[model samples]
Target chain A: MIRTFYGTDTLNSPAAFFIALTIGFFFGLTLERAGFGSSRRLAGIFYFKDMAVLKVMFTALLTAMIGLSFCIGLGVIDPSTEIYFMKTYYGAYIIAGLIFGVGFVMSGWCPGTATVGMASGKLDAVVFLAGSVLGSIFFNELFSIVKPLVTWGQSTQQNMGQEGLAFVYNSLGMSKSAFGFLFTLIAVVCFWGSEYIEQQHSDEIGKTGYFNTPFLRAFSLILMVSAGGLFVLDGSVNAEKHKAVSSSYGLHMSEKALLRDVASAVDHVEPEELADYLSNQDPAVIAVDVRPAKEFNAFHIRGAFNAELPDLPQFVQHHTDKRMIVLYSNGMTHPAQARDSLARMGFRNVYLLTNGLGGFIERCLKPVSLRKEPMPENSIRQINLWRAYFYSFDNARPSVIGSNPSADSAKFSDMPPFLPGFVDADWLAVLMEKPGLKMIDFRDQPEYNTNHISGSYAMSIENFRGVLDGVPSMLMPANVIAARLSLMGIEPVFRFSQKRR
Target chain B: MSSGNQKPYSNPYLAGVFLGVVLLASFLLLGAGLGASSGIARLGAFLSGLILPTHTFSSEYFGAWGEKPLHYYLVFMLLGVFLGGLFSAILSRRVQKSVVEKGNAISSKIRLIYALTGGILVGFASRLAGGCTSGQALTGGALLLTGSLIFLICVFAGGYAAAYFVRRQWHD
Candidate 1:
């Protein structure tokens, strides 16, 4: 029997590396073949110049996905043997996807395609690749600030060994085959729809005299083969890995059961046992204060360490082997929220302080002053805002500490650096002075409204792409920005910082 | 010269079929789906390490990649893709050194600027989204993820919405 290599079980095996390499190679080849190497070709989809990209992508997706499902149904592939699908991190994926898509349309080639394009001799592809590398580096440098969102976004069952699409499907009372069929149907519809749209716009595209090129055809064929090869290699390797691991460790309960047991184990630990564990030196029980910085600072358990809830997983991951991680928040919601988030990220031994911080104070701390004074609504709102700001700042501080000292020192240096996206404020000023300029801030609504640069329109980062609907420039349409500026009764020569740098 | 040099693109349906086979092969062979951004992210992690090793090692996100060398599965996969694309390009005699730009109305400089800016945004956004267009739209969408579907819709909407305004760059 040909063994299947699964993601979960392949980690410790030597074959995993080779499997990963083969999969990666095909993935890259397909992308290049798809003309994803060319910015113009990629952006052409938006302009209705070509829809082959969408069609080819969907067709491939349906083919592989349905095949996997079919294999599972036939018992040729055990669904449980593989790492199940991950839960939707709705907030993170939605926000990130929008930004990424805008970037995709704007940049012309995504990171993978750009690399291929660079190999194929495209200068723009090289520039784009450089930009992505820089951008990712920038992201890491600023991870402290962005850690909350990143951590929150990454939360899922995959981390906990309890999360999987199969569990969710079972909960919904739908068989795997049924869900697969539904999914396949939807994919087919989308493929057909995209094709229909392409046909509708074919005349317009053909008129541009760009569609019938031999170069494009060859690229398409190569892309198709690579894409197909990648799928086959990935599935086979993973399936084999899965078989090997399963044979070694017999059929275990699903990841869901494992996660549930973990959660329950943490929950079942009596308060006395926890207190005993905390008092004991070997079992090291850490009190995790998961509230905003202001709240944590104002009043928290004496021994509790302030690791923001969103950041608890990373903290735990880094400081492994903790006996108990008792997370507390201001109210009831935060403890459960934080606990769930951490659990999803595969952190074991995480517990929600029952009744939260309030409970802890009432039970353990026994504060002398139990003053219940409900502040006015406005004051309460102000306190909340301050707390949020301070919390974010506090959560962000650690990453700064963790990042390379050299990079931080360089930030303090006077020497000019040629960072890809780091535009000088002075240069921005120059661009701002150019005629017909408009600026759109793509930070979150609260962040934008709080202290955006003057004359910049407030477009929330969450729905940044929504503003582009019918506008040009995927980054920020000059015309729309201009119109907004014209409406504001101001005309500038340049559009600076239209979207996030 | 134009006729001799021009290579026709494969039929869309045929291309789609070939691509589908590849996708199926990935499933049967790898037991995992395709993703582009992770590979890019791995690259990012690798570069960050080269530039600032200490910081990259400490980063919760980038640190994951720091556990291994820069050339992982994704990197190799990407390399293979380039080779495959080159192979195809060569076979069709379509390999040429040229800048694919909009009409003469738009300067190469402008296109390059947009491309750079766009690349930066996309890179940042992919990290935010936890994936890119290929990972989310193609892979996840095939899996029938609601978020991916929503993302796919928004992408097309966002693109078309921006198309008309940028018409001067492409259409003019």
Candidate 2:
């Protein structure tokens, strides 16, 4: 398999249906042709009068076994990639198997064979199939009861490499080669035994089942020997060159594309689309109210997810799966600033609402009295709907909180004048993934080691500054900086050629 | 309506070989084994879709396959089985529609009732078993899964024991 789940994903696609139909056509034909379409023939196994079921099942199982073992050795089969296995499920399986077995003997049909019977015009099969479906529905409807029952036997029984017989032999401290040899011997014994039993009943049935002429038998013998030899000679059914690549999942959007997407989203979001997304609770679209926590809790859009600018990076990083994040605030500034920060981080799906709540109310739910003139029918209906949820005609009033001048937000305004090009955590995270960019952590090594963001290199602030000759903190000389960088194998700053500059 | 010149069914060994080849080809080509149970289960869910569409689509068990219940490959295969079986039965003249198939010791009425009862039980049990004869017994057996083999033995043991008690149902 190219990667995990690749096998099933290939089968689950649209074109695989034709292959499924073709495979099914042959599968159905083979089942029906083998006398499996009739319950009397099937039920005969219980009576020991007809050994067809055992012969058929055992033969098929062994055949696939040999074929798969060979394929695995030849690197053509990867068991985990293709074949599916459920958990050990000991409790559920045993009980279910007992009940299914009872049903199998009584009905004389299992689910698969019953389908074949129905196809061959057996009315009983139809009833069985219908009843099975109803039974499934009943199980689902009363899931509360069945959930606990099924989960009781949850245990990991994964065999080493999940190889067929190799697992059992490996568990028993036997080499896979010996297991293969023993496996071949067992299959031969079973084959011979089934033949002996079937031959006893050959006279009653029309067919002798001895399709293996001398040459065919010899050929099959060779095939079996080769299958066994391959398992021993090469290995079990696991991939030889098993390689899994761990991804450093950083979005690698091109600058042009990033600018185009973020620029478009940041400029405007239509009122109707935002309303529709929020109303339907569309999973792909997340609404972020960029307002403060206090304002968000007081009143906000019904389904909008809230986050301030400081916490937006972690929130966005946590939620990144090609989702569109819509940001809105009281006015345009907050959302516009947040969207820009996200855009620098190569996130293309972050959008700023074109207008704030005031614009939304004016455009989406303007009262007829407030309207300059006549309004459209749809607008009138939308206004009425908005009125129902948001407008309590008798008591509707906006909560007013006078601005607190000394609030925490004033800290940003009063910051030192020298720090102009401030990059937030969101932008820095994106820069970390870039090939040529470097993030020098201005913290102690222990602080960096504790839990720094991935891809940040530690560099102490103490190393960059020193007390120079009884003076307070002073920067290192250019020559000292050059020598320090040279020791670390980093290129020192170079002056541009005057003409080129 | 008996066709005197109708071809007999293939030899069991020959048919078994063909079945094995088909099973092997499925593993190689599709990374899956031959199965009919899940197809039927999905069909069951599809039927339930008409009655309880929301519950049918949202229920954790059935909903995993998403909105369309009949979209799985097994369902298509089941249809193919139906078509193939119909074609084979038509070619062999085995398509006579009758309500009963019982032996001399048992009346057709009693056998029919038993058949319906048995059918319901098997249907319900197959879901619980996570598979039926083809899926668990044949496919899992081929894979040599411990659980599948155990289930196989239990099914046979349960069937054999049950058959002893109901010998009259098939005795002729």
lDDT of 1 by residue, A228-253 (tens): 54445546655755654454343333
Worst 10 residues of 1 chain A by lDDT: A367-376
lDDT of 2 by residue, A1-501 (tens): 322222657666556777778888888888888877888888888876676787678767777877777676555656654666644456766777787777777777777777778877776677666767766777667665676566445434434222122244534566555665666566555656656665675557565544345743764586467556755555432232121101112355444444444422434576656766766667898888888888677567766778989999888988788467888888988887777777667566787776776666666556654553234465578777765655443223334222233333333323223323344344444344756455666644434443466776767665657767877569877777666655545565332333236
List residue ranges in candidate 1 displaced over 4 A.
A1-3, A11-14, A28-35, A151-161, A164-196, A203-501, B1-6, B67-71
Specify the highest-DockQ model's number.
2
| Residue B25's lDDT in candidate 1 | 55
Q: Each candidate's interface RMSD, rounded to one decimal? A: 5.1, 5.9
Which CAPRI category fits model 1?
Answer: acceptable
TM-scores of the candidates in the order shown: 0.53, 0.58
TM-score of chain A of each: 0.39, 0.43
**lDDT of candidate 1 at residue B100, scale 0 to 100:** 50
